[model samples]
Target: MWAVSAKRESPPVPEPLAPLIDAHTHLDACGAETAADVTAIVDRAAAVGVQAVVTIADDLDAARWAARAADWDPRVYAAVALHPTRADALDDAAKAELEVLAARPRVVAVGETGMDMYWPGKLADCADPAVQREAFAWHIDLAKRVGKPLMIHNRDADDEVLDVLAAEGAPESVIFHCFSSDAAMARTCAANGWMVSLSGTVSFRNAHALREAAAVVPAELLLVETDAPFLTPHPFRGAPNESYCLPYTVRALADLLDRPAAELAEITTTNALRTYGIG
Candidate 1:
């Protein structure tokens, strides 16, 4: 049996990198419960060179609040969607409202949507496979209708995710946020021109396969994110993560790919800009 330590405080932040952009995060989930919290969180992130973030929604209320948070800070943007596990919650009312939110000015993508088998058997909150597929399809169409990038969240259901994307024809831009699969899938996604966003999990001691994927990923297709308040990087694995803590993940990924941290910072920042369609 193995035991990872309980959460702890994060280590001191590394020296600033060139400006970075977080492709996916949940500032509200990270305890940023108010608009004021948004400013504070972005302030922490900016100090470490994270100039912007796309705070993603996992539920209907989150979608509503995510847009508001983006409006609260210039450095913030929003991605609105019903997360895969919450697919059942995508009732008609939710869909109608999400459409409105997705078309909002600072809402840059439709995402964190896809399949998840990990929570199916044991979790009461798990959405049915049929329902998840239905919601994912709707999200795909929503992305296309809005002409924004689609961000996918896949867990133990990569095949289904790809199948749906192929069936519906993916949007012009796609971001596989927190891409957890191995090098082979990474190559496949890259070949298809999908952006792969690596998160703090890549810094884990157990993530050799992820590191390998990052290594093989072309600079043009590679991206980075904090996915903060969870999956804090290697030495800070158990700590609560925030955008300010992103540099640690970049440093660890740089080591894995045998590239300089500053170099990874710049590459990912530029990748993020293109992915989010930011000017």
Candidate 2:
């Protein structure tokens, strides 16, 4: 019989890369299937060039954990709100709790919240057009009140999302995280002065449209993120993603923009800082 060692294994260490920001991430969900796994996941993110991450919460409990994590780790920033897929879960108590969390210094944005009908689950019935509109309005107002930019997540509902933003009036600095839309949508977003954050999907071979979209987006309006522990880039698509793997995604974006990876990194880093109001 083989004997197992008593020592615990350390998390995977990430290789150093040029400084970058994960404009959108769920640090609270990174290996956070249990309480003991949260800290290690964040530590791994910091080990890489993910200088700062806007950690989003889908509910009050996740928001509370995100707030605590941000307070403990200088590199972690919090974004408190109900994700669109979980829009029905946002009870009055949750909204009240988020209002308080939003005031915390480490809370930078109010999202990972928007519309998604492609694979709507529990929210299929509750997160209808009306619910999404209401939630979007509330979150937009919260962002304005707190003086933070809005981070959005739009999947298969771009028209509705754009219409809502235009109608309700979002802040000047709105970020479309993991923007996997077409060139026309990209052009519209750029024209409206919104930032489009690219993710691993941009690297997929079948994402030519996304690549075309990236190519035309102005440098000042482009940002990159791993959406880690979810949209892992190619060459490691099947593996669990982390911020350290951002270089692969960045490289792909660079190729799309016809610029050197270093230059693209600098441009996107600056854009992210500007969009998120980070120093």
Candidate 3:
């Protein structure tokens, strides 16, 4: 594990001038089930320059909530899909609901959907390589049909994920959410014109590989996220994360890319907007 400089308590609220987009987040997981919760979260995010957020809902109920939230709040966008880990639990009805969700105006992408083999128990139920491949292929085709980018969530199953992506011919604007891949994978994704969305994990001192990968990716294909309510950046590693704390990860990315924090902010915000097809 790597450590970051000790966290000083956040200073007075910074001016909301920087243009930023948290391309991937779980606003629903931020405990926002009511209008008040939604207002509070969006207010906090807006106060810190998060002009927009693409919130993902991995299940049917959450997907409904996310779509409703997006409809209610202009700043929120939604991505609806069945996560690969939950593939075994998805039935025809769930797929039908996802298809319906995909057509909604504010639902911009197809996922936080992809492969994950991080936990043995979860994988046991979804472990069949064929099942994972089919699920990934289905999502890829859905994105193509809907003309939306696919937001990928990859864990220890990189090779298989990449293989499926290649075989299925992923959409041009795929976003590898919370991307923590190595330079080789980064280069491959870059070569294929996929966007890499960095999260708080990149701030860890031990994450030299992730930093190097971040540096090598083209600025046009780079993005930043908090993966909020999870993976809080170093120094605040143990704290629950929110959109307001995003600058900490942005600052870390600035260091990694050897660019001014503001410049990195501009570049990443632009990249995220393009990737998510937001204004």
Compare the candidates by lDDT and give the number of the best one. 1
Model 3 bad stretches (over 4 Å): 1-17, 122-129
List, in order, the clash count of every candidate structure: 0, 0, 0
| Model 2 clash number | 0
- Model 2 Cα lDDT, one tens digit per residue, 171-272: 867889899889999999889988899998898988888888988898899888877667777655556666667777888777777788878877888887
Query: What's the residue-level lDDT of 252 in candidate 1?
Result: 86
lDDT of each: 0.87, 0.76, 0.80
> Whose lDDT is higher: candidate 1's or candidate 3's?
1
RMSD (Cα, Å) of model 3: 3.5
List pairs with backbone clashes in candidate 3: none
Q: If ranked by TM-score, best first, what sequence of candidates would result?
A: 1, 3, 2
- Residues 1-279 of candidate 3 have per-residue lDDT tens digits of 122223534324434547788877788887788867877887898888888888887778888888888987888899988777767656778878888898887999999688876743644555455665677788898899888889898887789898898898888669999998899889998898998999999999998888788878998998888787778888767666777778778887887777888898899988877777778
Worst 10 residues of 3 by lDDT: 1-10
Best by TM-score: 1
Candidate 3, backbone clash total: 0
**Candidate 1 residue spans exceeding 4 A from truth:** 1-7
